[model samples]
Target: MEKPTRLALLKEIAEFLNEETETYDMMQGALKFLIDGSDFTTGWIFFIDNEGNHGLVSDTNLPGALVKNNCQYMQEGTCWCVQAYSNEKLTKASNIINCSRINLATKAHYQETDGITHHATVPLRSGREQFGLLNVATPYTKSYSEEDLELLESVAFQIGSAIKRIWLTDQEKEAARINERNRLARDLHDSVNQMLFSVKLTAHAAKAMSKEEMSKNAFNTIETTSQQAVNEMRALIWQLKPIGLEHGLINALSSYSEMMKLNLNVQVDGLINVPSLIEENVYRILQEAINNVKKHAHTDEIYLKLSQQQNYLNIEFEDNGSGFNINHNTEHVSHGLNNMRQRVKMINGKINIQSSYEQGTKINLIIPIKVD
Candidate 1:
């Protein structure tokens, strides 16, 4: 590529990155664009999380051997570039003489490599934070010139900066959501919740003083309805702000279960210390689980256990209720399950639910803890 062409491509990539808001879409699009516009015929990007686990997030024009079995080889094991990256040795664009994945394909007699044997590897980073690696290859290319390496480094920098920008934006959005929830919770408590309380008090007073039986009955009904409304409004407020969570997750959950009129048996085997985000998510998920039991379980008691083993936190909920088929495919059940799954996924966790008719229901959650 010419100097002017390289500069133009970089400008285009910057503009493209600015226009993209989603991380995966931006990465996939950028990889395709880079390969299409440059001399490289294949490219891929890996994303390394805080715990040093890497995953292939984007790729383009992968050869048949690598693409076989849905790119099992690339996704499964570490390669030379990845090892160099983890060791902090691959800081800039440089030649990788022996790509491990490619070599594996060659040794296995997979001849669909498209003549690719080596690739240029660059660490994708912004300042002090390292994201992952970017590797690009062309057929029969053994080494990259200084200019070529420089161009790759520039593109990698662009990608790293874009990744950081998107991450910060997501953080800002989550902060905004939490702020909005707090505001709404406050408004409901001060207005609707207080009004319902007042209505309940007035009805109870009227019922106590009523002379006519009909009037007494009317007052009693009003009192009951207002009380139910107050309880529901309180539950909504708890979901929004989780008032007692600052004290501890167990305390908050116990308080919530009491409010919901469910008997909860708790057993904990390990110390409960985690980030606030994880606590909040767990609290929310358990709230839903308890609600499900109350509405469908035909039982009023729940068995809860929590334990920490190694770097994982495990939680289990069991109830001897009239459980339903897991594959029932009901709209409400599907939505609730999907919501729980999404919350767990956000924290890189896993959830499993088991239930059958005439039997009981059990839910298990496993969340990985990151240690610094």
Candidate 2:
């Protein structure tokens, strides 16, 4: 490509990156723009998280061999470029010594390579933080000239900076969300919750003072309604600002169980520190489990065991109560159980529930954890 043309393409890519907020879309669009505007016929980008897990985020014009099996080869296993980037050796744009995925494709007899044997790899980085790799390849291209490498490096820098910006923006948004939730929780607790408590107290006093049956019934009804409202407001407040979560998950659950006046037997095997997302979901699930037991299980005592393994966190809840058939109870299947399943699925975790009539219930949850 000509110098002016390359500069113009870079300008367009910068504009696209600036306007794009979604990471995957930004990367896929940038890859397409790079390949379509330059001499490169194929390109792909990889995203390496803090845990060193790599994912093929975007690609353009992949050959049949690489695209086979839904891009299995590219998605799995380490390649030369990835290893070099991970080891801090691939800081700038340079030709890969060999393409391992291509070699494997050739060995598997997927002959539609389109002469693609090597790729120019550039480490996507912004200052000190390393993101991943950006690779561009053209048919029959053995090496990239210094000027070409410089251009690739410049593009990679733009991509890396854009990614970092997006991540920071997301974090800021999340922090704002949490702050707003806490503020609302505090306001509700101070204003509406206190008012409901006062209403309950006044109604109770009025009921005791009234001598007429009709007057007593009216005051009694008012007291019951205000008490129920107070309980519901407290539940909402807990959801907004999970009690004792800042200390730990166990503390939060124990606090909730105490509020519910249920006997909670807790057993822990390992240290419990998890991401906020996981911790919140687990707390909510257990909270719901405790509520279910108190309402439907007809049991005052619950057993909970939490254990942390190398790459998985396991939690179990057992209650010996009036269990119902899982397959036959449509209400149970559709409500709380469904919500628990959705929560587990949201975090890429697994949940198992075993219950039978008069046999009690056991719930097991397994969540993957990224260890630093």
Candidate 3:
């Protein structure tokens, strides 16, 4: 490519990346632009995190037959370039190392094209953190020169910066969402919830003073509706605010149980301080479980046990109630249970539910804790 054309291609890639909303889309755009404008026949990118875990984030024009196998490898395979980058051995663009994924793909296809047998990779980094690796493959046998290396390194730098920007933007959006939720919670609790409570109290007094049977019944209905409304509004506020978790997870669960009129027995055996992310997830999972019991358990008492044992946090919730079978394929199954499972999985936790006809239900969850 000529000087003007090369410059224009780089500029176009940057502009397209800037317009992308998601990191995956940005990476796909970058790879596609590189293959079309440069001499590269195929391209792919991989992201590595602090845990030495690497996975493919984007790729360009993979063969239909190889897509499934390639994706599996992308998630499970790690190349020499990635290892070198992680070990701080390969920082600049280089063609000295061969990609393991490409080698595997070539071997799998006996009639492989000679155009894209190997690839060169550059580490994408921002400051001290390695964001990922950018790989470009060509058919020509000629080795990549210093100029090619420099150009690839420049492209890597741009990609790293874009990834960082996307992260920051997502953080800002989340913060804004939390702030808005807090504001709404405060307004609802202070205004609507308070009024509902007052209305219930007034109805109770009217019911007591009324002598006519019809009037007393009407007052009783008013009081019941107002109480239900107040309870629902308060629950909504908790969902929006979640400030109760700051006091402690145990306390939050106790308070929520009281609000739902369920007799809750809580047992704590060990230290409870954990990361906020873990704490929030545990709280939500328990909340969903408690809710499921309230709606379907047909029992008034719930027993909860929380403990930390050997680098893992264990939680148990048991209730003696009308039990039902768990059908995984049924759409009518409790969404609450499904949501609880999803939350546990997000934190890399394990959950088990035991239930049978007239046998009651037991929920056991275990989550790994990061020890400092």
Candidate 1: tens digits of C-alpha lDDT, residues 1-372: 353388888988999999998777998888877888788999999876544557888999998888877787788888777777777877789999887888887666568989888889888888888888888999898997888788899999999999878767764675577779889999999999999999999999999999999999999999999999998998789889888888998888889888889999999997978877678778878888888888888998899999988888899999999988997846887788877876665565768899999798999998877511
For all predicted structures, in order, the TM-scores are: 0.73, 0.68, 0.70
Q: Candidate 2, residue 306: CA error in Å?
A: 8.9
lDDT of 2: 0.84
Clashes of each: 0, 0, 0
Write candidate 3's Cα lDDT for 1-372 as tens digits.
443366787898888878876777888888888788877767788877544567677988654323655466566767787788888898789885565765676677635545565668898877775777898877754477776777788788888888777766764564576678879998998899999999999999999999999999999999999999997887799888675777999988888888889989999997877777678678878888777778887998999999998778999999998878875323434677877876665565678888876777899998878611
Per-candidate local distance difference test: 0.84, 0.84, 0.77
- In model 1, which runs have C-alpha deviations exceeding 4 angstroms? 1-4, 105-111, 211-217, 256-372
Q: What C-alpha lDDT, on a 0 to 100 scale, does residue 156 get in candidate 3?
A: 87
Ranked by TM-score, top first: 1, 3, 2
Best candidate, TM-score-wise? 1
* Candidate no. 2 TM-score: 0.68
lDDT for model 3 comes to 0.77
Stretches off by above 4 angstroms in model 2 are 1-4, 109-115, 211-221, 246-249, 256-372
